[model samples]
Target chain A: MAWTAPMIDEVTCGMEVNMYFPAED
Target chain B: MTGAAPAAEAPPIDGSARPFLPRGVRLKFCEVRKSWFLLAPERALKLDQTGVAVLQAVDGERDFDAITAHLAAAFNAPHDRIAADAGRFLAALIARRMVETA
Candidate 1:
């Protein structure tokens, strides 16, 4: 897809934050 | 370190229009990391030296031809070679919304 302002927003939105959780014993 | 994105966009560029970095976009050097990055409000990118130079050349006034010339002279390369390389790089930047035509 051609890059545009909306695409920037899409890409940014797709940037997910990850939180690590320790495994239960 | 991760390098800049590949030069993939091959658009027909108009040489007369100025190619500039949008005001909201930021190109910065990280002293601690010893690397360069292109940062927007929500995203940050790792950039190589050449990527830094490309962003630095866009001054909101120079056209594609002028920018190509500058890079050519800086690297002591031929105009045709620089033109093609710069064109591809700038095209990718344009696609990424990092550079704008003015």
Candidate 2:
């Protein structure tokens, strides 16, 4: 079997979780 | 003024070193991609078959030498070549704080 060097790719996802807070009066 | 953080030092990799994935890092298969990924906090690195084979051998019990030996036998490749490649790969991960040696 032919062996190749390990390769890595950075993965990006669009979905993200964020906490929302109301503006303080 | 703020400055860029210093680069992390590369970890020493030798035949005697036993490497393992540290906490917060995981090797998982993605169903959507049908590939393996080295998942870290807020980051994911897609790995090919060769990468998967190398990482799978890192069981924390086998040193670098043994790991290379196993890979060589499995792939019918040269021990020296596998040693060099796997060592470099692991070293890169170590520098990124993805893998640790014990």
Best by TM-score: 2
Candidates' DockQ values? Answer: 0.05, 0.28
Candidate 2 local lDDT, B77-97, one digit each (tens): 988888877887788788778
Question: Highest DockQ, which number?
Answer: 2
lDDT of 1 by residue, A1-25 (tens): 1121111112233243011111212
Error of 2 at B90 (Å): 0.5
lDDT of 2 at B58: 95
Candidate 2 wrong stretches, greater than 4 Å: A12-25, B1-12
Cα miss at B5, model 2 (Å)?
22
Q: What share of the true interface contacts does each candidate keep?
A: 0.01, 0.57
- Per-residue CA lDDT of candidate 1, range B13-46, in tens? 7878798878667776657567676665565655
Clashing pairs in 1: none
